[model samples]
Each structure stands twice: as structure tokens, then as C-alpha cells.
Target: MSITLSIIYLISTITFVIGLKLLGHPETAKKGNSIAAFGMGLAIIGTIFLNNLEVPIFIYILIIVAILIGSVIGWLIAIKVEMTKMPELVSLFNGFGGASAALIGIVEYGNNQADITQVTTIIAAIIIGSITFSGSMIAWAKLNGSLKKDIRLPKYNLINNLLLIALIVFGFFIVNGSINGEIIIYILLLFSLIYGILFVIPIGGADMPVVISLLNSLTGIAAAITGILYDNMVMMVGGILVGSAGLILTFAMCKAMNRSLSNVIFGAFGGDSVAAKKGSTIGGHIKKTNPSDVAVLMNYADKVVIVPGYGLAVAQAQHVIHELEELLTKKGVEVSYAIHPVAGRMPGHMNVLLAESNVSYDKLIEMDDINPQFKNTDVVLVVGANDVVNPAAHNDPSSPIYGMPILEVEDARSIIINKRSMNPGYAGIQNELFFNQKTSMLFGDAKETLTKLVQELKNM
Candidate 1:
């Protein structure tokens, strides 16, 4: 029985590795997800049947029922959620993962008194898991606009540091068995949750991708700790994969924004005052164009690049963009999407949107891969994208986005930006690209503008 369980575990681990590898690309991501889920199911089934736990059959039945209920809820949410709400959904799912780990730790601790090592592991899981849960919930609120303003207390840094120290001291007490274990554990849990809330509330909206990634890593670490407590090989491997991938993604997002993780967490870059100031900072007149005029430009162009952002998703313009892409393709003009790493609210957000429209995966280009192509492109159509194409990141030393990597859309022969207004982007910075000689603003909802352009193209 033990050997059979080990073999099953090994097969599950292998599938997890392959699935994760496939997830690196858009074309294979769905398959990878399905494969990984199958592996997890196998692991769960093996744990329930093969593990010689002397529990009642009724407990097994209850466990199965609980899993079915959770699975149904998860499936319904996935089916109902729109692409625009993907970031919020991701945040909520991460929170659930963290909460599950925390609960596992609490239940396990209550079941039997553990040795020092086990106690320490359980404490670690509880702390990290609690923080991930509360922090991710805050992140979700911010992403969904449920929380409108950044929340920061006076002397925030000092307070945060004090909380950290207190959590560590309580953890020590629990480990040493010097105090009432139950009471100390509860105190530790409370402080951890508070720390999580405080940790995320001050972060600005622009930094949400980084926060989400960081919280995901925390949840993975918590799961890994739980796996250790249970001696579950499959859980440990899956947790490691999730933790490492999330950490790598977090670093990549921070680098794209030219921000240190520390700064993202502590700087609170987009406050209400800063956002207001951003809107008030335009000094030059913007060149505006109609959709028909923009269509004429693209119709004559040899190549065009489309840049999509959060606003594009909000307007649900991806399908219209695809229509435009197809029209351009039929006209013998090359059309490609230039996707900045952090273009939307979360990592790979633009890609997911485009994918939903059945856009060719090959036409989607990464920032590094597509930057040089802009120089040869005849027109760059920025669809509700701002910060990613702003030259301020490159030219303005005093700018908040300075030193960040951006698409050099200004290098194109002509630029047309589709937007509802001259509003600043999430970064709370004025886009100098709007004032560029080569740039023209096409003011309207992205989908409406694109639809008009498609109509004009068809007429031509």
C-alpha cells in the first residue's frame, strides 16, 4: 500500500512539473491547468484512500461532501467571472488558498500536541497564511474599486515594525511552550491578520500586480509548510512550484515598473492628491483626430502595432481590436499587439483579454520582443493604454515612472490613442506621449472607436 501511494505521488509530481512548464506559454496554458488539476485530484484521492488513518467512514463521507461543495462554488465563479474582473478573481482565489492553509495548521495543532519542530512549522504556516489571506482580500478590494483610497496611518512604518516584532515574540513564546499555547497562538494569529491588512492598504492601485504576486508567493509558502507538517510529497512539490513561479513573476513585474519590491510595498505612490495633481499637469495642446481620419492613416500603413491596457479591458474592446486586426490583415498591412509586461491590472492580463477574442497567439509580442519593431512600423494604435507608452519614463528624471521600461510607440511614423478623456493613467502621471508631434488622440470609448475604425476600413 505504501509503495503504491509513493508511485502515485511520484506520477502526480511529474504531471505537475510538466503542466507548470506548459503554462509558460498562452497556447498551452489551458491544457497545463487541466493537467495540473488532474494531478492534484489524484493526490487528494490517494491521500484519502491509501493513508491508513484510523478515522470513521462518516468523516470520509463528510470530507467528500465538503470538497464537492467547494468545487461547485469555484466552478461557478470561474464560469461567471468576466475577463475584466480577472485580477479581482485571482486575488480572491489567493486569499482562499491562504485561508485553507491557516485552517489546516489550526486544526492539526488542536488534534495533537506537537514537538518543537512541528510547533514551529505550524506557527510559520499560520503566520504566513493569515497574512496572505488578509492581504489578498485587501488587494482584491483595491482592484475591484471597492476601496477607493489608499489607507495609511500616522507613523505607519513604525507601527508596522512594532507589529512584526510582536508577532515574532509571540511565536517564540508558542515554540518554547512557556505560556498558554492556545492563548498565545490566537494572539499570534490576530497580529498576523492585522499586519496583513496594514501591509496592503497603503499600496497604490498601480502596484496591484506586484502585491498580488507577492501574496501568491506567501500562500505558496504557507502551503509548503502545511505539506511539511503532513509529510505529503505531492503537496510539497506543487507548493514549491507555485511559490517559485509567483516569486519570479513578482520580481519581473517590479523590474518592469522600475520599482523595488520594498518601494512598492512602502511608497504608496498613488494617493488622492497625487492623482489630482497628475490630471492638472498637462502643459501642451493634444492633437485630436476622428476615427475616419485614423482609419485613413492605418489603411495606408505598411505595419501597425496595437497597445492594450486596463482601459481596453474595462471597455471590453478586445473583440473589436481583433476585428481591426483582421481588416488590416486583409488589406495587406501587418498588425501585431505590443504587450507590456504589466500592461493591465495583473501580469499577462492583456494577453488573456486578447486570447478571449480568439486573437492569434503568435501576433502578441512581448515588450522586449516588440520594442525595436515600432521604429519600422508606420502607425502605432494605443488603445486606452497610457503609462506603458509614455516617454516620460525615459526622458523625465523627475517623473514617478522614470526609469521604467516602456514601449517606444513614439518611434512610429504616426500614433493614434483611443481614450475616453485625457485622464492620467493608474500611475497618476501625465502622459507626455499625448503632446508628441506624431501622436493624435481619438477620444471615445475604446470599443466604440475601434468599431468606427472597423466600419471605415470596410468602407475603404
Candidate 2:
């Protein structure tokens, strides 16, 4: 590597590492984000200056238009989207990444499939990217509530494996053969895309975090291949960092749920004999409460913690929740936001949503940080969250969600949940916490419920 390229790589790597570290802390998250963005900017500048790749004016024009469109849409989302809905938006962004990678592969094949050395990378990129794109889209749809939140597919282990094998066999011919048919690559790409969507379809909603993490890893692999194609050191490094981080997260998610990564990958969960023996045989009995009663409970509490979820996203109520937090803080009640790693549909879903509402990053506490505090918390206000706060994670071995690490919300002195109804979370399992004597279900739109609570506090 040239001196300049090496230096740039080192700088970019440092920024990403530090940025990720800061992001983990919550308190330093803003600075961490700035650092990461700056690092990306610097790398882009370096790429532009390398003076090697000749770009047509039209391509530059395309970049300009893309930037304009992206900036406008991003700004609108930043301005208008509720914190709860951020997870789905992230899924969409992930789709963009995966689709871009796949398209690059398609373009590359059209331009240079005659060469043998390039074929492998090209095929790999296409496979990884298409799958990521389609899978992420499905995940986004689920998180956004744009699609039905159900495990829509039955177990099909044999068929799924055969499809993969077929894809592999087709991939071998496409990569090894020269200059005959680009149609094969297209067919393979389409199959991979469909497979990606199907891959996540059988997964119960409760496993979204794991799905998102795995998809992230796929996108990283695609980026890395693209980097090799272009001989871009910074891109390669970034891809490696993202890929490794995603894998680690995937493992962590599996461990948190007391699940094996293999089980998650293979879609054999529902039929498991162990599932009957160990799953969370939770409740079909769900109860509902209102906001004013919840407010009274909150007013009496010495301390309160708010748990947010995908339901909150669908309602777009982060701002109102922020208002509730501010009210709690003024009344001398301690207020903190408990964030679950996979609470919504993606990683950092809650964080970005809260940030969009201008919620102080310091107020957000991670699952690890907040679990201990729950015991001392007078009330746990669960806003549209189900699976994460369900006691079934600990008590039910027969449940599909059995053994997953969940917030010990049941440990709190009292708990209040706001949701549409007794709807099962993405995992299709009942939340047992609603039956707890200390737990009260608050049924309404999350936004409306929180608004009523805010009003009740004012009346107090």
C-alpha cells in the first residue's frame, strides 16, 4: 500500500473503532457519530483525489441527484418519524446497502464477465447483496408494521437446504464458464433474492434482532468484495469492521435468547421437541388499563423507567414519551429509558428514534445497565413493548422465546404496559407479565395513551 492509502486506512479504522465505542456508552454517542461521519468524509475525499478512476460527467451528475434525493428524504424522516418507527427505517437503509451491492455486481458482470479471476467475486457479491436486500426489506416491513407481523411460513428444512444447494451448483457454472450467458447470473441473483426473503419468513417476530444482525453481516461481506473489485483499502477495512461487528452481535443475540445460532439459521424452531419442553407457556389472557390511572401510579412512584418497543414505532410517540419523561423528572421521580438490544426490529432502533425526538442520550440505559436498576424501580412503564419485557423468557421452556435474556421488568415494584390490545409480539407468544398482579395493561394508541398521561400529570 502507498503511504497515503495506509495512513488513510489507519485513520478511518481508528475513527470507526472509537465511534463504535462511544456509541455503546450512550453518553458519548453524539461525538462518536460525528467522529464516524468525519472519518467517512475523509475517506471519500481521499477516494476523489486518488485521480485514478476516470468518471464520466454523467456519473457525477447521477451522484449529485442521488445526494439531493437522499438528503431530502433523510431530512423528512429525521424531522417527522417517531422514535418507535426508527427500527423499520433502519431496515430500509440496510436494504439500500444490500441492493446497491447487488446492482454493482450486475453491472460488473455485464461489463467484464469474460475474465475468470473476476467471476468469483462478482457472483459472491451478487448472492450476498441480493439476499441482504430482500431479507432486510422483509424485516423492515415487519418492523414498520407495513406487513403482517406473523411467522408466515411453516418449517421447510429440506426444501430450503435443497434450494441453497441448487443455487450453489448454478453459481459454480456461472463463475467457471466464460462469455456465454449473463442470463444465468440474473436467474441466480433473483433466486438469491427470493431465498433471502424466505429465509427470514419462518422466523417468529421475536427473533428480528438476530435476523437484522445476520443481514448486516451479509451486507458487510458484499462491501468487502466490492472493495476488492475496486482495490479500495478503506472500503475493505470498513467492510471487515462491519462484518465482524455484525457476527459478534449475532452471537450475542443468540446467547441473550438462550438459543443456538444454528437453530436460528435453520428454521427448525417450531418443530423442536425441546421447544415443547422448554418454551414459555405464557398467557392468552391479556388485560387493558388507561392513562390517568397509570399517571397516578407514576406520580406516587419514587422512581420510574420507560421501556420502548416496536409498537411505539408504529404509533410514532417518542415526542410524547419525552414529554412524559420530563414531567416525571420534575416531580422528583427518577426517569430513565431502558433499551433492549433487539427491542424493535433492528439494532440502535430505539437510540435513533429517541435521538430524533432530541431525547438526551444520557437518559437512555442499555439492557445490561438497566436490569439491575429494575429491582429498585418503583414502576416500569412499558410503552408498546411485549417480548422484551415478558417474564416468559425466564419461566417458559416450552415457549419459542424460552431462555432469551429479557428485561426483568417483572422484578419492578409495579409495571404498566401500553399497547393496542393483547396482540402477541412478533414471536407469536403471549407475554406472561400482563397476568402479574403488579402489572397493569394500558390499552390505546401508544401516542394517545402517553398524551393522556401527560395531560393527567398536568391536571395533578
Candidate 3:
């Protein structure tokens, strides 16, 4: 690479690091993304203009056209996508990254330009990239409700293990030139695609967050392998950063859920249709309350903490919830949010949703920080959250979510939960918190109920 290109790569790498650091907080996330995007743009331009490659003008035109098309489509998706669908969109985008990496490997392999090291990297890219792409698509489907049931074959674990072993052995053979036929490479691709499907299909809705994180990390690893194949500094640095960050996040989420990576993969813990079947009756009558009652309760409370879940996003009630928070704050009630790490469909889902509605970042407290505060809280309002706040995680050993850390809202003086119906949450199990003595279920759409409660507060 030319000195100018090298300098551009260095700048890009620095921006990526800085941007990732900024992403640690919601307040600077948007700015961090913009900075990283700018770095990527610079790297692309530098590669096209500064790299002394004898590429044809037509090829350059084609590349430019592809970039334009992809950018336009991505922008449209960003603008049109609802917050509820953000997780699916993220899954799709991760898949695209994997697909791109896989294509790079395939093209390089066919070019006959690879040494043994390059060959090894190429095969690794193909396997990991194919898995990432296929697995992400499955995750998207599940998130969008297209695939509602977890489909597991008899002896699926053995099957999956065999497929994985085969893939590793095949990839090794290809790298060593023991496999010389084009058909062999194509077979490897087919097996990889199948393995990806099998890998994700058995995973239930409850573990979707961890699966997404794991697939994202795989995509990054594939990108890094591709970068190694091409000796591209920017791509290598960026890929390593993404891969490591994603891996760390995946492990963290698993820990939060009190499940190991092996368990998440093979356990199939929370199957959608079967979860309700697996649930034992936490027999207690639920007390239903109206919006007026909830508003009156909050009005008297000194400190209030709101817990948001996927239902909040589903109803597009983020802004309304923020309005309620502000009203309570104006009334001299200390308001904050209790954010469970695995609360929503993805990591940081609650924080992002609340932030979009202009909620103060300071009011958003993580599970560990907020759990202890619940005992001192005057009232706890759970908006569309279920599994994260479910007492089964603490008291019911037979429950699928047993031993998982929860918000401990039951410790509060009063509990008001808003939900559209008595339907179970994503885990497909009834929440025992709803039946707690101090808990009152406020039944209605989150947006409508929260809006009414806000109006009631104003009337008071």
C-alpha cells in the first residue's frame, strides 16, 4: 500500500476505536456512529484513488454504482424502519456484512492468487461468513414472527455436532489442497449454509439476543479473515475491533441471563410454543387496575421507577412513556428507568428506545444499579416487560428462566404493570410478578394507557 493509503487506514482505525468507545454510552452513540462512518468513507475513497492498481475505468464505474445502490437502500431502510423492527433490521445488516465477506473469499479462491496461508484464511472466511449470513437471516425471521416455533429434530444435538465436525474437516482439507475440485468448494458452501440454519433453528425466542450477538461476532471474524487474506490494514483493524467487542457483549449477555454459551447453543431453553407448556402454575389471582388508579398511585409516590420491555416498542409508546416520566418528575417524584440487560429483543434495546423519545440518559439505570434501589422505591411501573421482571427467575427452580437475575420490582412499596392483555411475554410464560400482593395490572395498549395516565396526572 502507498504511504497515503497507509495514512488513511491509520486514521480509519483510530476513528473506529474512538467511535466504539463512545458507543459505550447512549448519549454519544449517534455521534460515534457518524465518526466511524466518516472513517469508513475515507478508507473507501483512499483505496479507490490512492492504491496504485491498474483497474479499468468500467470496473470503477461498476464499483461506484454498487456503492450508490447499497447506500440508497440502506438509507431507505433506516428511515422507514420502526424502532420495534430495529432488531430485525440489525440482523439483516449483519447478514449483509457476512455475505460480503463470503464473496471476497470465493472470489479470492477462484483467482488462483492465494498461498497456503491465504488459502486457510479463505476457507475460514467462507465457513464463518456463510454461517453468519444464514444464521442472521433466521434470527430476522424469528424476530419478525415469521418463524414462531423452535424446530428441533430428534437427536438434533448430535446432528449439529456432526455437521460442525464435517465442516471443520472439509475446510482443513481444502486448505491443504487435498480437495482440488471446484465441486468440493461448492459442497463446502452448501454444508456451511445448512449448518447455519441448524445452528439457529433450534434456538428459541428467549435466547435470540445472545444468538444475534454471537452471529455478529462471527461476521466480524469472517471480515478479519478476509482482511488477512488481502493484507488490508483498515479492514483487519476494524474487523478485530467489531469481533472482539461483539464477543465481549455476547458473553456479558449470557452472564446476565445466567446461561453459559454452551447452554445457549444446545439447551434451546425458551421454545416459543413449548414455553407455556413448560411453565408450572404460579397460582395467584391478579389485581387489575385502571389508568386513573395508576395515576393516583404515582401521584402519591415519592420515587418511581419505570421498567420498559418489548411491548413498549411494539406499541410505539416510547414517547408517551417519556411524557409520563416528565409529568411525575414535575410532581416531585424521583423518576428513573430500570433497564435489564436482556430486557428486550436485543442488547441496549430499552435504552435506545427511551433515548429516541428524549428521555434523559441519567434516568436510565442498569439492572445491577437499579435492583438495589427498587427496595427504596415508592412505586414500580412495569410497561410491557415480562421475563426480565418475572419472579420465576428467583423463586421457581422448575422455570426455564430460573436463576436469571431480575429487576426485583417485587421489593417496591407498590407495583403497577401496564399491558394490553394477560398474554404471556416472549418467553411464553406467565409472570408471577403480576400476581404479587402489591402488584396491580393496568390492562390496555401501552401507548393508550400511558397517555391516559399522563392526562390523569395533568388533571390532578
Instruction: State, as a TM-score between 0 and 1, how close model 3 is to the true structure.
Output: 0.93
- Quantify all predictions' global Cα lDDT against the true fold: 0.88, 0.80, 0.89
Question: Which regions of candidate 2 are displaced past 4 Å?
Answer: 1-28, 42-49, 53-81, 149-155, 268-292, 334-337, 351-378
Give candidate 2's whole-model lDDT: 0.80
Off by over 4 Å in 3: 25-31, 271-279
* Tens-digit per-residue lDDT, 1-460, candidate 2: 4568668767987898888789777579899999998998777656555545678978778876886898799779777865555556666778889999999999898888766768778888888899999999898876555666445454566666778787777778887783248677789888999888778776655567688888888798899888888777767778878898889989987876678888887754543453454325444555566787888988999999999987887788989999999988999999999998777666577887888788898899999999999999999989888888877677766666777778899889988988888766666566768888888888889998889999999899
Candidate 1 colliding pairs: none
Q: What TM-score goes with each of the models?
A: 0.93, 0.82, 0.93
